[model samples]
Target chain A: MLSFVGLGISGFESIPIEGLETISTADIVYLEQFTSPISESDLKKIQDSIKGEFKLAKRWLVEDGNEILEMSKEKNVVLLAYGDPYIATTHIELRARAIENKIKTHSIHASSSLTSMIGECGLHFYKIGRIATIMSEMKSLTTPYYVIYKNLIEGNHTVLLLEYNQDKKFFLDPKDALKGLLETEQGQTRNVITESNYVIIASRIGFKDQAIVCGKISSLKETDFGKPPHTIIIPGRLHFTESDALKLFGKCIDEPFDNSEKTEKISNQMMKKYVPMVREALEEIEPLYKNQKEFEIILDNAERYIKDAEIFLGEGRDENAILSIGYADGLVDALRLAKGLEFKM
Target chain B: MLSFVGLGISGFESIPIEGLETISTADIVYLEQFTSPISESDLKKIQDSIKGEFKLAKRWLVEDGNEILEMSKEKNVVLLAYGDPYIATTHIELRARAIENKIKTHSIHASSSLTSMIGECGLHFYKIGRIATIMSEMKSLTTPYYVIYKNLIEGNHTVLLLEYNQDKKFFLDPKDALKGLLETEQGQTRNVITESNYVIIASRIGFKDQAIVCGKISSLKETDFGKPPHTIIIPGRLHFTESDALKLFGKCIDEPFDNSEKTEKISNQMMKKYVPMVREALEEIEPLYKNQKEFEIILDNAERYIKDAEIFLGEGRDENAILSIGYADGLVDALRLAKGLEFKM
Candidate 1:
């Protein structure tokens, strides 16, 4: 039988009571720390608590699960990891393989920093959208940038996980990640990330020296957040209670504010620009076709569609709104072209 | 000083090692069961483990918080709750208030069912979008319906938390919530939910009797999911690995497939219909103005916009695609109307 146990986020002391017993009684235990590094002191304490043969598992050993599966066939084995074990896709795949091989498998879920940091920052967990990871080797940060944009438009907070390479003992600095996002903003121009945008840098969470430093991106450009294993959170709309909690929960260099305000949805952006433009174009052509009978119907249709576009937009039917405005603009511009005037579309 | 400790997803046996110590050494410990009900046997075990004064806290006591804060001012007080302590917004608010009252606060983060259940179901945690709660008293399920729609369009999973009332011992049945979504689909025709859509019902997770039953809505209609504290998961796009793990992890009445395939983005839906309609309209109007020099540019521009719309749609610029197609349709309709034909828009 194979048991997958989580060490939770706080090193040795945060493992669940059941997980402790599982590890102690197992014939062989493999502790994998590639996802997140463990402290040396915690490592010592964990070794002292286990009565079984403890072996440190590398990333490759867990990824290539032959040895673990073979050992679990005859003896009780526990594979422990940082955070919740199955958060890593590799672990889930291994579990599936174990089941396929007819080896009974058990899981002991523990604390994950993904969910903990949000509460530690006093942010509501339900408001968090899809999370994104920023790898240092990525050619561009556009994927994570657009993720933040989508989450912001929906008034949902975004949790950005920076790269952690345990083999290299490397961690992406929060400052560098922020800089990459700003650079992405220059190319994307969706107003997702800006200098004045509020962000929180939650470092070493679930540890005694955990620090949460937040402020405008500009203010944090020079600030150094100590230690590794940091996460960046770009919050969306904030309730008053959330704002109060945030102010008290972390070191905020600036007042807490909504990042979603500036990042408008694409539908809204198109409606804002096209609605008035189409209306003005319709008015311009309406006067030109005052006496023309055939053109009169086109102008009337254009006017009605302009009104319908606004109503559709108000009803949250954004695609319908854009379509209506575009059709109105087309109607007015066709009249302008037939009249030998400059087109407005 | 006051401490907020998480009991994790399991019963008393799942409490973190640090959490156990925190509760045993505190002068007073208040175990709040309003968030989730604890088994009587587990409650008895918890009482036996805590050497301090143990008190059962109701929802009102935790929300009011005044009495707890007063006690913490002079004594070592601990507030224990199921799952992660800070997952409940009320706990966060209380922690903030504690800080405001000049009291020191500490948090022992543990396993949150929110993150754990995703892994248990073999779904990627990063793909989870903003979660929503469905209550029996809600006038309409439209809010959560739209949330599922939005998450589906983004290819993200939606975690629907069923309402749990500790005082009334009431839990919203997963079938009722599914039925409400189906009813919502009748009024709002977004193809977000249908009888064919796949869903997973996770019940009593982290307990010995935990069950993960999943299939198409029709397949699950007559199925009985045994207990309360159930959560419904609507998966979006499915990676092959996720499908494999899900099938291995749960009881599937039907084959696992992508729920997102049927739920197309509104922009894509619009383009799918409008692009061809506009092209046919343009083709019909082309011969009418073949020789007219003044109308030549209108026909040419319409053809160009139609092609541009398709290009933009392929590039994932959905708003631009909708705008360009709408413009093309308007151009075609105007020409058709001027030529004594009925408008197609």
Candidate 2:
């Protein structure tokens, strides 16, 4: 049997009670630290507590799991990892392969930084949307940029996990990650990330030296967030209780504010521009062809559609609002083009 | 001083190593099981392990927090709860209050069922979107229904936490939750939930008899989920590995398929109907306005807008697509109305 166990977030001390016994009793235990680096003291403590043969597993060894599977066939083997073991797709795949090979597999789930950091930062976990990862080698940060945009418009917090390459002993710095996001805002221009946007940097969560610092991006520009394994949380809407909790729990360089307030949804952005523009265009063309029966009918439809558009927008039918405004704009523009007037669309 | 420790998903065996020491050495240990119920065996084990004064804390005690906060001012009080402590908003609020009172606070993060259940079901944790809770007393399930709809369109998994009323010993059954979603579909008509929709009911996770049963809602209608603390998972897109892992790790009543495939995005749904309808409308009125010079400009613009709408939709500019199509329809309709024909919108 092959057992997968999590070391949880706080290194040796956060491992589940059952996981301790599983590692001690196993014939062989392979500790994988590629997901997150472990401290020397915690590593020593984990080694001293285990009675089994201990081997450090690299990322490739866990991914290419022939030796682990072969050993588990005859002896009890345990593969331990940082955070919840199955959060890594490679671990889940390994478990599936073990089951297919007729080897019994067991999992011991432990605390993950993904879930832990939110609470440590005093943020509600339920409000977290789809998580995004920022790799240092990526050509562009558009994917994660839009992720934050979508989450913001929906009033959901976004958790950004930075790249950690264990082989290179490299961790993506939080400052660089923030800079990348700010740069992405230049191209996307969705008002998602700005200098004044509030962000929380959760550094070394679940550790004794864990620190959570929050402020606008500009204020945090000169701030130094010590240590590796940092996460950035861009909160959307904030309940009063949440803001209070954040103020009491973390180091605040500035008062907490909602980032979602600045980032408007695309449909709303369209409506904001077109609603007034379409109405003005209709007013401009109204007297030009007033007494003509067919043109008057077109003008009447344009005015009605403009009114309908505003109602749809207020009712949260954003797509319909945009569509209605566009139609009205089209009607007025068509008439202007036929009469050789200035184009409004 | 006060400490908040999570008992993790498993009962006594799953507490963090640090958490166990904190509870054992604390002056008072208040075990709150309102979030989830602990088994009798686990309860007995927990009581035996605590060397300090052990007290059972009800929901009110935790929510009120005055007693605990007062005790923490002078005594070492620990509030140990099932799953991760901060997952409950009440705990976060209490922590905030403790901080406001100048009481030192500590947290020992443990495994959350929120993250664990996703892995246990062989689903990717990052794919999880915003979570929704379904209460038995809710007047309508429309809120959760739309949440599922939004998550599905984004190809993200939805985790539906069932209502657990600890005082009444009442837990919303997984079957009832599923039925409620189906009923919600009748009014919402978003194709988010139906008899044919696939779902997974994770029952008593982290326990000995934990079962992850998944299939179509119709197939699971007669399934006896055995116990309370059940959670329903509505998976969006299924990666091949995810499907294979689910079939191997859980009881599969039917073949795993993408729930997202059946549920189209509202924008896409709009485009599907409007694009073709506008094209048909344009075709019918094209020849009638062919010779008329002023009306021909309108007809030409209509044709261009229709084509632009299709291109925009294909490019994933959904709002733009809808706008373009609506504009085309209005142009065609305006010309038809002038000629005493019918309306297409």
Candidate 3:
């Protein structure tokens, strides 16, 4: 039989009661630290409490799964991991493989920092959107940048997890992660990440020295976040209650503000530029073709479509709004093309 | 001091080891079952194990918080809750209040069914989008219906939590929730939900008799998903490994398939209908202005813009695609309107 147990977020004591008993009785217990590394003192305590043969499983060992699967066929084996065991898809796949091989598999789910940290920061969990991880080797942070943009527009908080490498003892600093996002904004220019944006750095959650610091990105630029295993939260819309809780629960360098308000949707961005540009182009062409009866109808239709576009945008029909404005611009520009005026579209 | 301890997803065995110690030594332990119910056997085991004074904490008592918060000032108080204590926003709020009242507060995170059921169903946790709840008294399921639509379009899985009223001894049936979504599709008509869509029903996860059943809505119409605590999962895209795991881990009456493929994005949906319609409209206008020199430019530009729309759409610029097509349609229809023929916008 194979058992997957989680040593919750806060070191050794956070392991579920049943998880403790499972690891104690197992013939072999493999502790995997690739997800999140445990402290040396906590490691010693875990080892001292275990009755079985304890082995530190590397990332490849768990992923390869040959020895663990083979041992579980005869001996009672437990693969103990940090956070909820299955948060790592590898463990989920391993469990599937065990079931496929006719092995009885058991799971003892424990606290995960993913679910724990939100409450720790006093943010409502239901408002969280799809989480994105920032890797140091990525070409651009565009994917996660857009993820935050999308979540922010929808009034959903984005939880940005920094990359952690246990083998090299490497953890991406929250500052570098934010810096990458700011650089992305330079290229993408979606106005998603700015220096004045509100962010929260939740450091060492569920640990004895846990700290949450909330402020604008500028305020945190020089602040020292003590340790590794930190997460950055970009809040979208804040309820008064949430703001109150955040103020009471964490250290505040600045007042909490909504990041969603600063970031405009792609449709809104286009409308802002094109609406006035189209109107200006139409004004220039109207005088040039005033006496031409055939051109007069097209000019009138163009103005109507532009107005309709704004109304559609206000109604939340974004695609239609963009389409209307684009059509109106095309109409005006077609005349500009015929009259040898500069094409505005 | 007040400690919010979680009982996790399973019965009594799922509480964290430290949580167990805290409850045993506490002067008062208030077990709150409002989030989810505890079985009689588990309840008896918990009562027998605790040396402290045990009291049942109802939802009102916890939300009101006067009694528990007042007691914690003078005694060692632990508020025991089902699954992760903080999954219930009320518990999070309670903890916030405890901190505000100058009482020390601690939390023992446990297995949340939110995370547990996804793993149990062999779905990747990172692929999940923002979660939504379905209350029986909700005027309509539009909120959850749209939540599924957004997740499906992005190829993210959605976990739908049903309403559980402990006071009334009631839990919303999975079928009823599915039915609500189906009804929503009829009114909205974005093709987000249908009878042929694949879904998974996860019932009593982490319990001894945990069951995960997957099939199309049509196939599951008469299927029995036993027990009070149940959840419905609407999967968007299926990676081969996820599909393999699902097949091996759960009982499936029908082959699992991606619901996202059938539901086109709103832009794609419009393009499908408009591309052919615009082309047909352009064809009709060609015969009327074949030799007219000035009118010929408008016709040529309209045809070029129509083709450009398709190219832009194929390149995944959805908004630009819709705008191009709408522009083309307006250009063509403007010519159609000037002529004695009918307008085809």
Candidate 1 Cα deviation (angstroms), residue B250: 0.7
The residue ranges of model 2 lying beyond 4 angstroms of the native Cα positions read none
Error of 3 at A277 (Å): 4.6
Over 4 Å off in model 3, which ranges? A276-304, A335-343, B283-304
- Report the number of the highest-DockQ candidate: 1
Sort the candidates on TM-score, descending order: 1, 2, 3
Q: lDDT winner among the candidates? A: 1
RMSD of 3: 2.2
**Residue A101 error for model 2, in Å?**
0.8
The fnat of each candidate, in order, is 0.87, 0.72, 0.60
Cand. 3 Cα-lDDT: 0.89
* Candidate 3 C-alpha error for residue A110, in Å: 0.6
Tell me how far the alpha carbon of residue B246 in candidate 2 is from the true structure, in angstroms, after superposition: 0.6
In every candidate, how many clashes are there? 0, 0, 1
lDDT of 1 by residue, B1-345 (tens): 999999999998889999999999999999999878899998998898888899999999999999999999999999999999999999999999999999999999889889999999998888898899999999999999999999999999999999999999999999999999999999999999999999999998999999999999999999889878899999999999999999999999999999999999989988888888889988888988889988889999999999999999999999888888888888889999989998888
Question: Could you tell me which 10 consecutive residues in candidate 2 chain B have the lowest summed lDDT?
Answer: B334-343
Model number with the top TM-score? 1
Q: What TM-score, to 2 decimals, does candidate 3 have?
A: 0.95
Location of the lowest summed lDDT over 10 successive residues in candidate 3 chain A: A336-345
Query: Which of 2 and 3 is the better model by lDDT?
Result: 2
